[model samples]
Each structure stands twice: as C-alpha cells, then as structure tokens.
Target: MKIEAHDKQIQDIFSLGYFQIPRFQRPYSWERDEVENFWNDIINDVSENYFIGSMVVYQERKPYFGIVDGQQRLTTITLMLSAIRNSFLRLGEDNLAKGVHKFVEQPNIDNEAEFILDADTSFPYLQDHIQSFNGLKIDCDVGIEEQKLKNAFEIICARLEDEVPTSNSESGGQISMFPVDVPDPILKLKEIRDKVLSLKLVFIQLDNKSDAHLIFETLNARGRDLRTSDLVKNLLLSKIKEGNAKLDSAKESWNSLIRKFDDASESEIIDSFLLHFWISEYNYTTDKKLFSAISKYVSEDEKNANDLLKKLNHAAAIYCKLIDPGAHEWSREETDVRESLKALRLFKVKQQSSMTLALLRAYYEKRLTLRNLKACLRKLEYFHFVFNAITSQRSSGVIATTYSSHAISLTGAKGNDDIQAIISSLFNSLRTKLPQYEEFEVKFLELSYLSSKTKNKGIIKYCLSKQFGDKFGGIDINHDAMSIEHIISESTMKDGLSSDVVGSIGNLLLVDEKTNSEELMNLTVSEKIKKLEGKGYPLAKALVGEKFPESSGVQDRARSIAQHLYNSVQL
Candidate 1:
C-alpha cells in the first residue's frame, strides 16, 4: 500500500486530474450556512495562504481519483470559481473570465471541456450552470444535491456582486474588500482568481482500494469525528469484498434508512436506530456501548456482515415508526396500537424504547397479536407513569434491564401460551419493585410537580390531559399558553407555613394565564375554592372543599387525584 501526504494548491489539484464521488457516498448536502462560513473564513483570514483541511483521494488509475473525503469543500470551491467566471463575463472581461473558467474545468484528450468534480446527481447541474459563462436560475425538480449546488452558486454570486461589482452592472457597488471605485474591475477579478488558485490544501493519495478504505476509517475516526452511526457503516462497508453483490444491496438499504431519517441529524437518528436494533436482536446494549457491542457480535467476514446488514435493513423500518408513530402505515390500519405508540411518543420516555422495540419484534414475528401489543403498551404506560415519571424510584437503567430481560425471555418462548406467560411474568416480576397505591399517592403529594419547572411538568400535563385524553385526542393542551395556578395565592399564606408547600401538587392546577391572574389571584382560600369549583380542569374541580393549603385535607385530596390518575391509565 503506497501513500503520499503533501500540500497542493487548490488550482493544481483540479488542474489536470478528475475526481469521482463514489456511488455509496452521501450526496452533496452542504447547506447555506456551511457555504457562508467557508466564504467568510476565506475573506476574513489575513494570512498569505489559507490552508483548508485534508483531502483523501484514492488514485484509481492515471488521472482519475476517487474522493474518500472532502467532497463538500471541493464542491463549494468549484461553485465559487463558477460564480467568479460568470461575473467577469457579465462585466465583458472576456479574457479574465476565460482564465477563471480554466480552473473549474479541464480539457480532455478530445479537447472538450470536462468538469473536474464528478458527483453522481450533482454533476449535470454543476456542468450546466456552474461550468457555464452565463448564470442561469434553476427552478426544475431536482434532488437535494442539485438544490445545494444552486444555493451555493447564488450565495457566491451575491457576495461577489456586493464586494466587487463591475462597471456595466445596474448598481456598481463596491463594499468591504475595496472602496467604491478603488481598483480596475478586471484587475480585481484577476486578483481574486490568483488568491483562489493559491489556496493551500493537504492532499493524501492512496494506492489501492484497501488502503483507501483503511485511511477513510482512520481519518474519520480521529480527524473529522465520524458520527457513531457513520462509523458503524464504515466498519461494515470495509468488511465487504470489493465488487461484491452485497455491496450494492447494503448501500441501497443504508441509503433508504438515511432518507427515512431525513429530518433528524444523522448521529441522533442513526444512533437511536442502532440502539433499538441491537436491543431487538441481542436483547442488551446501551446507547454508549452500541457500536462496540455490534462490533463484537458481527464478525469481520462477508456472510456475517451481510446478515447484520439484512437485519439492520429490516429493523430500520420498525425504528422509524418508533421515532415517528404517525408515519407508521399500521397507525392507520390499527387504531389501538396507533394510539398506544402515539402516547409513548407524547410521554417521551426514551428508555421505554426497549419495551416498545420488544413489542414490535413480537408483532413482526407473529408471536404477539395487535391486541396483545396494545395490552403490553398499557403495562409500559403504567410502569412509566407510576415509577419512572411520578415516583422517586426512577432509574432508566432499571426500566431498560426489565424490558430487555423480558425481550430475551419472549424471544426464546415456544408457543402463544409461553408468550402470554412471559408477558404476564413481566408485570409480575416488577410487582415488588413497582410503587404501590399508597406509596405512589404519598410521593405524588410530596412532589412540587405542577409548580416545579422540571421536565416532569410535561408528565403532569400528560396525566391531567388524560382525564379527557380520549375527548382531547391525547394531551392536546397548547403548552405555550398553559400555566400552573395556585388555589391559595403565594401572597396570601397567613400561617407562615413553609414556602415549599406553596407550589406543591396539593395547591396546583393547570390553567391559562388569564384565569390564574384574574379569577384566582389574591383571593381568600374559600373564595378561591369557589372560583376553582367553576373551572373545567378535573384537578381544580377536585379542590372545591379543601380548607387551607398543605393541610391533611389537601394531602388527602392529592392522594385521591393520584389514585384517579393511576386508574385512568389503561392498565
């Protein structure tokens, strides 16, 4: 494996050779912010030569190189050069325009101008608009890479117009780099061309495909900080033999997964997907240990890698549904299962993913019915509300272990009777660990749940919303407009009771801002209770006859409310 690392000017790198973005590579996805940052960095730095970071290329043959990294920067630079060339042509500086265009495209043996950068979907767009002397607006239906190229071109053109406009333009404006009418326009364009051509970049060339893949893994792990999922992908891709059928199949499956998670960051979506996938397959893997766990189980052989990839492809569908319950097609076909998953998302207990993953695996394997899946979800809801959300016995690790254990047990079961027994044993196993009614009520009363600004505010809101959960279609409160109201005002505490009790669940109600200040503020306890009785929230209505704040009567009322909330959950 031969390797060379040295510095090359931006112009020299693209002067004669051609580079291809591999089919497995992600598309050109740099957005406006990244383009603007690159532009500003070049203009703001005062050094004689600005060094953009490393670029790794695999020397395929004589002049064609496969880009292993740095596609984003190289693509953006080409767009800037294209903008400069177009600007000069618009200014009627034909000689300067031709000079700048040479850096963007090189002539082939046939003497036709060939673009240096050859992206899969973005190459045509770049060739048509960016490689042309005339700038054209793109309004056609295109993929994300094409859109990104268009956006970069527009930004570069706008910036150049503001910084160094030509004489024939409508408003000949010259701003930051030069005072208005400071230098010759043609000379200025030539200077910009020289600076761009002289920009320094580190280039690493690899001799063979295996060496290129190794350097790709090493560089991303240490330098650019590969997202965890991308690291897993690189590892798996490295295992496949070159030119194998599984390579294309794996790429297709991986690309489909990325498209499904288009709205989320690759790290977040893929990491979460991997966690659920591992749990469903192996029954035990934490978020932090996911990649390592996978690395241990999936051997560095073609068959094992292919099997793992196939499982990942299948599990990716279930993982997408777990992230977005509404996007699941089954959500439309099965109402109960849909509602259960939606409620899980609303709850936002990420640890519950273990149990949800288990239930989904059962459903997919046909060992569990849709009815049983909903039943299992109810048990999860009860566990989350009572122990994870409401009580002091909260530990995500405990919940994860419980669910993971049950998943393993379920996977090994023989028949439907065994499946039912395992599901029954799941609840029974946690009976001793789960908080009972009295313990739950006591903890619930002690909590400053509604008044505290903790995340539990959402959980309490969920509980209150479930009173009308069916009618309101599940926790449909406009959170931005909601507030926690005190029946006995903070300013009217006569007994000098601890201020801590002023905001406890005993005196709290969820209300709109207007109602809190107008009807309930500064009222005597009995007057406030009278006003509260007329309010619509069930928690507020339950507080009609309580005498004073934080009294045993209020605690009793809180206990009752807690019991009511517990009963309201479907379990």
Candidate 2:
C-alpha cells in the first residue's frame, strides 16, 4: 500500500493529468441541489486556499489517470469551467477564453481537442454539449445520467448568464439567466473562473490499480457522497487491462446491464437493484458491506468478475419484471403468473424477489413447468398477504432466509421432478409460515382504515375484492372502478358508534361507484345489504348479504370475517 499525496488547486489537479473517469465509474449524478451547493461555495466569502476534498486516482500512464474517488466534484468543476469559458467566448475575450479553456480541455495526441475530464459514460454528451460547445447535430438519446449532465451544464450557463447556445431541444430553448438587465458581465465571469481555479483539493495518487481498489472502500464506506454500486463496479473492472479491446466489451456489458433498468428510478437502478441482486446471488448483506463483499468476491477468483456481471445482468432483467409486472412479456396463457407477480409487488413483498428470481430462471430454463411456477408464485403472494400485508410481521429472518434457501435449492434442481419437489416444498413452507388462523383472526380484527393512510384504504379494498380468496389480481386493486361502501355509514358515528368501528374492515364492502354513491347512501344496514344483493358485479356480491355486520356488533362480525378470510385465503 503506497501513496503519494499533495494539496493542489483545481487548476493544478487538472494540469497534472489527461484524466478519464473509468468505464466502471458512475455517471455524473449531481442534481440541482449539489450543483447549487457548488455554486454557493464558489460565490460565498472564502479564503484563497479554501479546501473542497480529496481525490483518489491510479496512474494509467505518465499523464493519464483513472478517477477512483471525487469524480462528482471533478466533473462538476469541469462543467463550471466550461461555463466560464463559454461566457468568455461569447464576450469576445478570445485570449481569456483560451486561457480558461486550457484547464477545461487540452489537445489530445492526434491534436484533436478533447475534454480534460472525459467521462466514460457521458463522453459524447460531455464533449459535444459542455466541453467543445459544438452544435446540436449530434444525437445521443439522453438517459438519466446524460440528462443530469445536460442539467448541470444548463444550470451553470444560466447562472453565468452566457449567450452561449444551449443544445436543449431540436428548436433550442435559449435564454438569459435573470429577467433583469445585466451590467459588467466580464468581471462576474472572471470572478467565477478564478474561484473555480482557486478551489483546493487533496490529490491522493496510487501507483497501482490494486492500491486504488484497496483505498476506494475506505474513502467511500461511510461518506454520504458515496455511490457504492459504482465502487463495486470499479473493483470488478480493475483487473481488466486498460487499452485492451476486451475493456470496451466489458464496459458495454456493464452499460447494457444498466440500460436494462432504464425504466426504474436512479435509486432503484443504483441502490435497490444492485443491493437486491447481490442478496439473491451472493450473501444476504446490507449496502454498508456490499462493496467490501463484492471486492473480496472478485479478488478471490480471476473469473468471478465476469461471472458476477452475467449474474447481475440476468437478475436485473428479472428484477425489472418483478417490480413492474408489465415489464416482461407474458403470453396470453401466462396471465396468471403476471397477475400474481403484480399482486406480490402491490403487497410490497421485496425479499421474496430473491426466491422469485430463482423460480423464474428455473422456469426460463424449462427446469420448472409454468404450472408449478405459477403455483409457487401464487402461494408466495397469498402467504405474503397473510404474513406481510395483513399481520405486518417482520419481512426478514425466517421468511427471507427461507426464500433465499429455496432459491439456492432451485438452482441445482436435477430435473422437472426435482424442481416440482422444490416448488412443493416452497408451497408448504409458505403455508406453514403464515400466521396461524387464530393469530391472523386477531390481527385482522384490529384492522381499521384511515382516510389519510393510503395503504389502510388499499387493504380494505383488497380484503373485500378477495373476500373469498385470491380472486382478483393487481388490476382490481389499482383500478378506480369500485369504491368501499360503508355498510353502517360514517353518519352512524354521529349517532353514538365509534369512528374505529365505523371504518373497521367489517363494516366496509367493495361496491361499484354508483352502488356506493348516494343511490345507496341513506339505506339502513339491511337496506344496503338488500340493495347489494341484486347487483351484477363481482364485488357487489363480495360479502354474503346476510352476513353483513351491524354497526354496534362490528367486532363479532369482524371475528367471523377474519375466520372466513383466514381459512379461505388460498396460500
């Protein structure tokens, strides 16, 4: 573990290297808040030697280095410098612009202009939009990260109030920063460039990739500014030789893995999907230890890095399908599986994805039949409804461990018979893992809906729709085709009944909007029950008319409904 450290200003740091953010490094992810914070730091009263933070890099060649830490800061500073240069360029300060531009980008080996801080992910956009300030003919369909780069550059340009053309839309939406008249723009622009060049950072350089990998985890483990998934990717890709064609392939593979999750959110892509896939394929661990575990895992075997990426790509595709039911192509006959998977997502069953991923892969391999797969998924969904949704038990421990164990077992299943055996075991396990009918009855009895809590409302509707069992899929839960009709109305609360009993699960029934509206509003309990009996809808016949509970005796009726739900629940 050798290290060389120096305190360098932003200008000095950029001057020391032809830097490139590695393929594995995260894309520029600073949002308005971070960009705004950096802007404030630049304009705020500060010392000439004001410190930002440390940057960790490993040498690729004499003047080439790969950024391991502080990429966000470096990328941000580069964008700000480009903004300053744009201001100077627009103001006819050619020499001044060239002076500032030297820090933003320098001539590459072919004498072609190149960005000093080239990001592997956003190079074209960074070059065309921010660095080179080229025209809008270049087309790269913007993803989340690219959009952030555009936004950062946009914010900086607007703040600087440069007449620099912004490559916004095809028509190009360009405007000034403030509505008011500006005075003495050159002095303001020089001030910004000077502040940017003045900012100091601790430049920590390592002689080798191994040392950089070793230092990355320590720097990032506890930092609020860390992106752990990107760090994990760095550790995985470190061993691959730079300038090798395989490096490009590996980088593309990583990018493809990221692209599979295009529809998911940033947190979902970087945080949730990465963490969940690691749990499914490797050890069940927290985000805190995931980087370390992955680094060690990759270090242990030469082939592990490629193996892990393959697993991740497969799991990411599966994960997208798991979280969003419509993500995968389900055949007309496979609607049950899609519907049941959606039900699991609605129930907020996350850890079960560990098992579902394995189960789905087995089905994909033809090792498990669709029938058995559907059965296992339905049971998991139903059991989660009982154990997770209704009882609200801890989602971890026995249940999570059980799913993980079954997923592992499914992977090595010998044949169809073996896969079916695991499926049966999974089904029985889910059934037994459910809260005993008595326990469920107790919990279900305590259920009350509040107008403010959306989940509470959802649960009431869910219970009524599936009063007999898993009769409806997620479509029923999410649609507004029906509303809960209070058998004993909220009006009854004024007549001496309690609010809890009024919104209790026992007093609620799913009814069509018309049936639930003023048409049946003024009816007595018996009248409402009678009105529901003749309706030609599924939820209209949700509860047996006679079993409809009275306002005062809601507890007794809650007990009966609980008993029925407990026994009839399809797990």
* Cα deviation of 163, candidate 1, in Å: 3.0
Error of 2 at 326 (Å): 4.0
TM-score of structure candidate 2: 0.85
lDDT of each: 0.70, 0.74
What global local distance difference test value does model 1 have? 0.70
lDDT of 1 by residue, 243-296 (tens): 664456566667676666765545577788787667755758776677777776
Runs with alpha carbons beyond 4 Å of true place in candidate 1: 24-37, 44-48, 110-113, 121-159, 166-181, 240-247, 286-289, 295-300, 327-333, 392-398, 408-414, 432-439, 446-457, 468-556, 567-571
TM-score (all chains, Cα) for each model: 0.77, 0.85
Tens digit per residue, CA lDDT, model 2, 121-218: 77577777778754474887787888999899888878766433323312222234423465445666677688889899898889877777667767
| Residue 408 alpha-carbon offset, candidate 2, angstroms | 1.0
User: What is the TM-score of candidate 1?
Assistant: 0.77
| Pairs that collide, model 2 | none
| C-alpha lDDT of residue 439 in model 2 | 75
